[model samples]
Target: MLKAQQSTEMERLLMAWILLQNFDVQVSRFVDLISFLMADCRYQQMMKWIGNIHETLSQLFIDASPLDHTTCRMAL
Candidate 1:
């Protein structure tokens, strides 16, 4: 499923990093996913993608944004 994201290209990876930031969830699950992806042999080909994921996570922690963000709303 993730194979199609096969690119270290910075521009695309940057966009992906931003999206990941806005949607980050459980820390363990997120880290586990990135760790698994990093261990793959094909990973070197997509280093930027994986690296940006890590970078986004790092920035999230460093930014010190307050929790309790805008409340969720459901209407469907």
Candidate 2:
């Protein structure tokens, strides 16, 4: 999206909120997939890719909550 145009503040915020709302189930499924793939020949490389995805998701949560810092500070 950034390549075409920057998101409006509201759009970005909404994106983050949506991402967070679904993240619990999303990450759980990702973990299961990763575990299932662990015996593959590419296991080590797959772990690194999954780790990067996780970091990106974490950043999304951060980006979403900065405007209302207190909201993000609460335990998820």
Candidate 3:
């Protein structure tokens, strides 16, 4: 039989950071929060968190770059 998997603290933190944006979190705070998540020893969760961060930043840049958000204030 297969056992159910549980989330580690790092994964939980990453999930929380992802959800925080829905609650109107500041972008800089969200980036800072990722640093806390990266401290965990769980390799898989850490990689997932890295991917999530990369994806989010990539999309934000994609939107901001075309909109002339060089100051980044309007995009965020």
Candidate 4:
């Protein structure tokens, strides 16, 4: 009977270890996914800022007179 009890305990311990390993893998995957999403979000925000700057510059060029354009070119 004692041997049977020991065997059962060993089985339970093995099962628990396996479950913990699986949990660790799942947590690692979740962390990786979150990191990828955060990077993508940052990339999208940078693109939006670039678009806004381009639009503003386009408008500036359109509205500027010839003298202003000459001045701008010289400044550049």
Largest lDDT belongs to which candidate?
Answer: 3
Query: Where in model 4 is the C-alpha error above 4 Å?
Result: 1-42, 69-76
TM-score (C-alpha, index-matched) for candidate 4:
0.33
Window of ten residues with lowest summed lDDT in model 1: 67-76
Tens-digit lDDT string for candidate 1 (23-76):
446444555656655665254657666866666665554454445222211110
- Stretches of candidate 2 off by over 4 Å are 1-42, 66-76
The stretch of ten residues in a row with the least summed lDDT in candidate 3 is: 1-10
My TM-score estimates for the predictions, one after another, are 0.43, 0.33, 0.42, 0.33
Location of the lowest summed lDDT over 10 successive residues in candidate 2: 34-43
> 7-57, model 2: which lDDT tens digit per residue?
343354354446556544454454444344333323366457655655654
**How many clashes (backbone atoms < 3 Å, residues ≥3 apart in a chain or on different chains) does model 1 have?**
0
User: Which 10-residue window in model 4 sums to the lowest lDDT?
Assistant: 19-28
Residue 50 lDDT, candidate 4, scale 0-100: 40
- Evaluated at residue 42, the lDDT of candidate 4 is 29
C-alpha RMSD of each candidate structure in angstroms: 8.6, 11.8, 6.7, 24.4
Model 1 residue runs over 4 Å out of place are 1-24, 41-43, 65-76
